[model samples]
Target: MNTTPVTSPVSNALAGWLATAETRANQKNEPAWALAKRSHAAAVASSLAFPTRDEELWRRTDFGGLPLDSLDPFAAVTPARNIDDLPVLLLTRLAGEGANTALVAQTDSEVVYEQTHPTLVKQGVIVCSMDRAIREHADKIQSLLGSLIATDYDRWTAVGEALRQGGAFVWVPKGVHAEIPVRLMQFLSGAGRLAAPRTVIAVGDGGSVTVVDELLSENAEGASMYLGGTELFIGQGAKLTFASLQDWSRNVYHYGNGRAQLAKDAELQWIQVMVGGRMSKTNIWFNLDGEGANAFVHGFMFGDSRQHFHLHTLQRHLKPNCTSDLLIKGCLKDKARSVYQGLIQVAEGAQKTNAYQANRNLLLSDQARADSIPGLEILANDVRCTHGATLGHVDSEHLFYLMARGLPRVEAERLVVEAFFEPVLERIPLESLREQLREEIERKIG
Candidate 1:
């Protein structure tokens, strides 16, 4: 137990780290407002201290030996001149054939490759890196970049904004339908590097779009970290489906936060999938702010070896007649562990709000562990809110029955685990994504 005490953000160690990060921020040569935003974010981040084990939110996940201030802020990368120069690992991970309406590839802090379908271009869709968006579409992004997610909310978020490098920005014009998903592949190849990517997606009135964002890495010789953030805004009567998959190598520590807001009669489908990382913590929130708005949240995690996963979710209803539903399932093998916490809150005057949440975990080995906490707070009189959590191992009888049918023990267990996650998989609208998730799970189980 190395309880030397967590260092404060204002400590000399962090001040040095901030200076390193600021130097990287200045290298971007962005506009004046963008530079000012980064400086302001740095100040805000400095005011918040790092989370200690004493904090309720971080009590379960151990943070020992994690490098918070000693990391190389941003390792330099040779920018890819074109798509052909992109890494093969990244190119192979693209969605199934013809499944992507646009593709964006990133290596470290550079956007290496970007392409959008001609149809999408004609429909007034904007898909490009954050740098280009700030230069070309500042009017649209100025008000919404950090609006939904406040910089000072937490340690991860505050520092994420200050140090975030390259990110993808997406916009769907009113009434346009980007039916095919857009894929964003971000890969960190630098050892001991700290990578932070911020993404924002906005859909105009009556529009719809689907985006698949993948945060991944190749096998690294040394440990690294990823601080990521995402913000989504769904306009009136619009629809947006956002799927984020975290598959960093086991040598990475991952911290991610995302917030989404829905307008009147809007629909949002939020999906989170976790499979890699030595340790990971993710926070997600969905705000139903207009009457008739609805949101569906889905998440799944598979951990093996000594991996640790912590997932937190919030479904908030701020207007009458708004509805939200959430379900998250996870499976662990070896000495893996997971912690899940979820909350459903209905604010005052949010009458007729309907909300539901559930977290289910399955342990494959006796050494595996899972902790689930579900809660609800309702200030409205006419709201229906419910939450549930379940933790269990594979049913012996079910495995025996499968084995009796001439199946091997390992095969039987795989069958049971696959069936456990089938419900959530069936809800995914993209076949390619569902297949990719299954493939990743199979790799983990084996």
Candidate 2:
């Protein structure tokens, strides 16, 4: 293990936790390289300060009182004995998805179950726990672990790097196509706990795959925090479809960061749904690094009570002939509040680049509020870029039209909210999953 410098900041919350980095790695039976990585990240994290409201991205959300020093970073859970032993919230969300090509489940910070189809295994497809991948596929993990998102990006990422545990990893060989989706489920419980999970996915040239990531939590008395990160790498001519849904309990604070890099002729479809948690902040980014690369993003959220949700997105064009589009819609009621910021940036030499961004919000209560900010930065003269945003209350004409019929006021409002998100929901490829999302959105409306 590397020696910790005496001059590093000792007042940071993660400084004390860094002292046990090596011991925790050894207890988990991790390899020497893994321990070395953890030690290096811990040393860096100890010097970094937690985020504050001064930063532009952090201005809308504040996590200063999250009780990081009191939470147990390495709280553990026993492995499940069978599928029936998994968290009920996770099982219920997966009820109508039918059969998946592969499935991985995590409870608290432990990976309890992993199942992959035999055919996918024969085709050189790999889907398993990140811990198993670190031991079995050390070479690959070593090369791509921090390739897309750096370990020292920010306070949350730095701490997550040093303390992340029990995640999922998926790899698809060249020229193969997985018709069904690969499912990843996570559930967090207990108070005064911190759950940090990282997922890495790579698709070889000419390969294709779909992934569904879900997060849930059981009710608890005290507050808990969830920090998650995801990285996706698409090779030349490859395709990837990703869907993420988060529904943590009211006592949980959620933070997520997701990014992807696309090669020449690559394609990506991204979908996001956020409906739960007392306060949440999320960042989604896509880099079009290769010519002819294309991407489309769709996202929606529903908030009620005193929930606060902040979302940010970036569409970066680094090569010529690249195209991207993004749309995010949200609804808020009661004392709920939301903030959305989106940017489309095009590099100097990236000509013929086409990009678009739009954010729309609906206020369902007098006290509800929302803010939408959309911008563009195009250095290329021949590129086409545009953006638009709208924030308004529910259309009274539409509500009155439905109410004049036989529907009640509450039911009319529900229908209007559902219709507002219909465009985004229609993009989902799976019918069963679409219906499931609809049901969940309707539940949130109430």
Candidate 3:
């Protein structure tokens, strides 16, 4: 790993802000364990080299034009606002009637609002801010915070962990089953500000939970930056459904790292929808560590204007009889561009493992671009692995067929594009959320 300090203007600005974050953490009376981790991450971030265009992972995506020094890493938190101001669907999902869900909302650095249903509280489910978790659920938080997505994954991960101010922590006890989902909303409100949130979710043996995370901005005016991390742990025989929706303003730049670890007989279903952000880069990983483990990852992306997206995924099978599947689809228009890179690895002892990966892209305009790279590494001869990628334009015959049936040309094209994404959209568990995504897609298609 490269440890030389980066000399870019962005790196230097981040270094100065990280130093200030350490000072603030010390003065806040933070727990010793949490403080130590933050300090170590900050040091690592300062020494690590920033990603350049030469690196294979970043060669296609450019970050050279970003004015990193103009963004504030230690911006002050704005005052809290009423939940009524948010969208009706989001409000219903977060704190709806008869729903045993937990909700946490953060703006800038502070957790402006947090609530947990009383019934879930009685069942030993913990849903609160990271700050509160560090003070109240110290043992559980310390054991799982950086266990999955370690701080050293890259400079961005280290920056997110070191400077993170607030996020959600959820724990479901053994044998407990949460019928309703736990929801977290992180909103960026001001321009030239930085938002870094770290989320950790752990389900005990035989337990189950559904989690939904949303990242949004008020509008598409001022420029902002978002650096975030997420870790999920599923114990033996446990099941988890995780979904993330990112709709930041067109002026914001976002980067995130997410990971999940599964034990024997554990199952994980992950869904990600990306429809916003000026330039976004996200990396997701899954580890199957025990027999009979299963995982499924699905993602959707839509980009317009000059927006850029770089998405990467990894699936690692370390035990026997494990299964994994991944499918990511995107549509690009105008001058937008997208890149998808995926890898599936089966260890030597991971016999009877089955894995599949695919990425499909649709170019809606002549100037739009999309790149897909899918790979597999199998050390076990008995295992089965496959990978494929496709990049194509809208089928002209299909469009013409729809137009001949009394639909306008634009409407026909939109319908065909919607059909292209329906396979992934139909898999979303929530009807309301699915409809919301459909509406967003429709708006973009127009």
Would you list the C-alpha lDDT of every candidate in the order shown?
0.84, 0.84, 0.86
Which portions of model 1 show Cα errors greater than 4 Å? 1-13, 95-100
Model 3 agreement with the true structure over 51-124: per-residue lDDT tens digits: 88888888987766668898887777754465555544456544343244578888877787788888788889
Supply every candidate's count of residue pairs whose N, Cα or C atoms clash at under 3 angstroms.
Answer: 0, 0, 0
lDDT, candidate 1, equals 0.84
Model 3 is weakest, by summed lDDT over 10 consecutive residues, at 92-101
lDDT for 323 in candidate 2 is 91
Displacement of the residue 192 alpha carbon in candidate 1, Å: 0.6
TM-score of each: 0.94, 0.94, 0.94
RMSD values for the candidates in order, in angstroms, are: 3.3, 3.9, 3.8
Candidate 2 deviant stretches above 4 angstroms:
1-13, 96-100
lDDT of 1 at 340: 95
**Quick one: how many clashes does candidate 1 have?**
0
Question: Candidate 3, after superposition: displacement of residue 277 in Å?
Answer: 0.3
Give the clashing pairs for model 3: none
Better of 2 and 3 by lDDT: 3
**Per-residue lDDT of 346 in model 2:** 98
lDDT of 1 by residue, 218-292 (tens): 777677888888899999999998888888889889888899999999999987888889899998999999999
